[model samples]
Target: MADTALPGTRVKVPFAGQAVDGFVLARIAESEHPGRLQPLRRAVSAEPVLAPEIAELVGDVAARYAGTRSDVLRLAVPARHATTEKADSVPAGTVPPPDLAAWSTYEGSAALAGLAAGESPRLVWTVGPGDDGIELLADAAVATASAGRGALVCLPDVRDVARLDKALVQRLGKGRHVVLTADAGPAKRYAAFLAVARGAVRIVIGTRAAAFAPVHDLGLVAIWDDGDDLYAEPRAPYPHTREVLLLRAQRAETAVLLAAHARSVEAEYLVRSAWATSVALPRDEVRRRAAVSVTGDSDLDLARDPRARSSRLPKEVFEVLREALTVGPVLVQTPRAGYATRLACESCRTPASCPACHGPLRIGAAQAPPSCTWCGTVATGWSCPECGGRGLRAPVLGDRRTAEELGRAFPSIPVQTSSAERIIDRVRARPGIVVATPGAEPPAEGGYAAVVLLDTWLLLARSDLRAEEEALRRWLNAAALVGSTADRPGRVVAVGDPARGSLQALVRWDPAGFAQREIAERQEAHLPPASRVATLTGPAELLEGALAVLQLPAGAEVLGPVEVGDGSEEQRYVVRVPRTAGAQLSAALVALQASRSARKEQHLRVDVDPVTLG
Candidate 1:
């Protein structure tokens, strides 16, 4: 390979994802022995994107995942920053609403209270979904740092950071704080990095990548929604934000507050092992123990029929939704993305494939032949070749379609779709036929006339170990829109078998208990918040060949020849390496590259603490 040198100077460090040339500032004397030893050259950064501590975290993540540190660093640092404030150290703490109203009663309040008071060094809390617990944790984080300490609050995605930012703005004021997210531009991010490294901003609100945020005398590290898949970085050094924060908390000797609607099994391990203490709401308080009807697979069968919506949507759902809309506003929740779930041909029981690439085809026509968006190949015109029958595969549902159906169902009421596209800024403040995606569900136009979870199975069908946890989170999101978000009691009616969903949590308005049971199952399965599991992906043949030479620790076992990608029959392999052997197994597999074994074999992907088992 051509000698890689960054532009500007001889110091070539991995910048963004690619290696670019830059001037290196420091070079120590040589080690006793070495290979690939290159002299350090200098570059003009004018400023560095990552602080030393932050860079170290990337390296730690790499070692943990058996992947390159460069990729992990990319996810943590923003592509750019809007603006960076110079270091201006200031202390701040939790500010309750003027009324002390319900502000002091935020779920994570007690956990933060004990830590700031120096009574607890580490606290783990599992809250039910939609408790505004992240806001509460933000309150505690501010308090911890305000008491002469530093704080880092890392969330799963930029969306969450934005939510927390608004809350922080209202609670902590706009000035004297730093917000770091991937969405921001570069020069600005580097400047923000400088602020944290130099002790300018004592409080940092960032995405999973921000687990590396540098703050001296850190008193707290909080991870919101530990169960969120968004927190699991998709790139190399596939580190989970929760693990990163736990490590940071341990290193800094600061208290960590896992303020999640549901506790993760990995986090439960921390509590069960005495690594951290668990604070949660009672089971009966956070779950819906009441008897409720369920609409599931049976209901979906009816909706999928092309004839079902001919006149005005599925009769049953239409009637239920119609009746609910008359009461106030009806909440309809699909998956998080508007049109992510896809449909397949009913006859073959196989998802329609792209004519050329065979990639999954999305529905584009009403009763029209399905054409692969990727290849433009049209399958048999609405007929199943295998069965000689005309039927639809699974029809992907999104808020757009749901809203359209609702409009048709209730012709009189106005229906609005709420998602990233049509964001409801203050969910507690609206009333309408709010058809929403999971996280963006708008508050009830008057506490939804009724909540209809359009695709209940989608939540349960996720490949992640925390599928149930996520389902609860979505249930809570829908329930919140129906119930009072600002502490007023309310009611919610879900579409599926009340038994299948967190109807108990809704009826009882308890998210804490769901989190508890969810954590227990994860712990039992040796999932994260329990024992760690790593996923290695790439070309199947390459992975298998690599696996052949992989030497895991004695205590660890390989669990699969699990299917990965479909590049080729053996293009992918899912190798489950136990946490104890994670580092060692990954290192060993990587070591096979001494001769560049993977170069011609397959691409290598390592996911540390993977959320999705599939």
Candidate 2:
């Protein structure tokens, strides 16, 4: 690393979703980015900042995300702790695992063995409710350590860290490893960073930011769920943690494992590209544990009204919930977080529109007039834009709505609702109507008596390209929270159309197979996995000129001029490319960087895997 602690030079200061002006801290002798590079304006960390190899990882992630390098570094290093101890002068040798018996006997035993062999780290994807051997994953650091390598376990949140930390402490002994996360406060987190930096603590477990942990002789990098939006670090140079892990593993020649119950298309791409292999349990094991029933099956989509919810909580769901509650605690999963997620006209099925501008109406503050989320124009008498109709419906349901219905249906039982406002432990401790937003599900007390997968259509209804993959992830996370011991598996039921690809994966408990099929679609459409994609939407006039000037190399394909929104809006244009053509396309985009005309008239969103591509 150079003496980046230098005096003066324009430095790109990294911030969340924004950039700021700053100057260089110093220069380096041998830095990662040798060109277009300046020193740090000031020391963000009191200790050794992000490690050089980790920086390399960040660089790779930035390249893939098409984001700025500084922003990637910020995601990689959320904070720096105060432990400034230089690494110890220990000689090279193997360290015995504290819990060898448990390590050798973990679930996904075959997959764990692949990891133990130091295979280039690959993400391990799975489905069902979450709490399966998280501690065992944390403990793998001990096994990898015994094999003379360092391991870094990056989790999504503090709750996960605490959950996994307890497992590590109980099984491997407390203080045997180090825990790192942003919530730990600067001083403590920094101390943990240095502990690993100096080799005092070899096994490093932390939240998203810990992807930058500096551990020499690194061997494995594992991310729980590669699809969670939380892992995407919402910053200027937004980079996904999974991408960073893949890059870090490659540069360090370390093993990578992405662990999740449901597999993502990206994870499947790794397997298809020979970057990683799939690690899963037997079909019968998962089936016998949890008998899944998908509503909307042609055979049986019995709505209580028999009319079908199409997207709402069908009446039959209430029946299932009633029975499941009698057996034990039940979970109801919804798409939105708040009390009322949407506002619709009663006369027409179309979404309500603003009077001033023909934009969709949003719900919030009953006193406030209905306004367009897109144009922010106050709407007059509620009406639908497509048909001067007076009715609109929230195709997607919210946790509050689901909870309200459950409370009415199951009047005798104690009911609880968990959203962003309520903490995880509160929901985890309940036994009643545990209505939760996707990914917000708390650990179930006695494993959910039944987990009603509501609003399955909202996930499928998204307009992004990877909609199916993302929905499956949300479904799987809810399922993971509803698991039981080997003797008895939990019961999980879906309340919407199970005819979609997501249900196929959930019902059969075959995420890998589902992902394989989805990737094939993307590949056939010349989309992600097979091809890199970018989405741009705004105004028609501006997009017209932008599209005319954009250039691509021989291998790249620019397929859109396709408009988003309604036909009248003409607000979308999509770009497609083979993965190998990224550099050329990236350079072209840099050259055609939105001109004044384009910026003023239309907006552009550069997304690699648009989760909704409807």
Model 2 scores a C-alpha lDDT of: 0.66
* Candidate 1 lDDT, 183-254, residue by residue in tens: 666665666666776676777888865677777677788888776778777666667788888766665577
- Candidate 2: residue 151 lDDT (0-100): 83
- Model 1, which residues run further than 4 Å from truth? 1-39, 43-52, 69-109, 115-121, 127-130, 282-328, 336-381, 384-397, 420-422, 427-431, 443-450, 463-465, 485-488, 498-531, 539-541, 574-603
TM-score of 2: 0.76
Best by lDDT: 2
- Could you give candidate 2's per-residue lDDT for residues 1-614 as a string of tens digits? 23433333233465544566443444556777658753333433234445566656665775666555666656555443224333332332345554435433324555565545554445464533434647557656666776677888888877778888887777666666788887787767766766676666677888877887878778888887767667766554455677777777777778777777778788888888877766666666666668788765454555335556443656566677766665677888887876555676666565665676666676544345556777877665665656667655565456666676667767888777777777556344345778888767777665776778876777788777667778887888787667565666777888666677788788888888898898888677887667766666666676777778778667766656665647566566667777888766666664555353345644444555443455
TM-score of each: 0.76, 0.76
Candidate 1, residue 589: CA error in Å? 4.4
Ten-residue region with minimum lDDT total, candidate 1: 1-10
Each model's lDDT = 0.60, 0.66
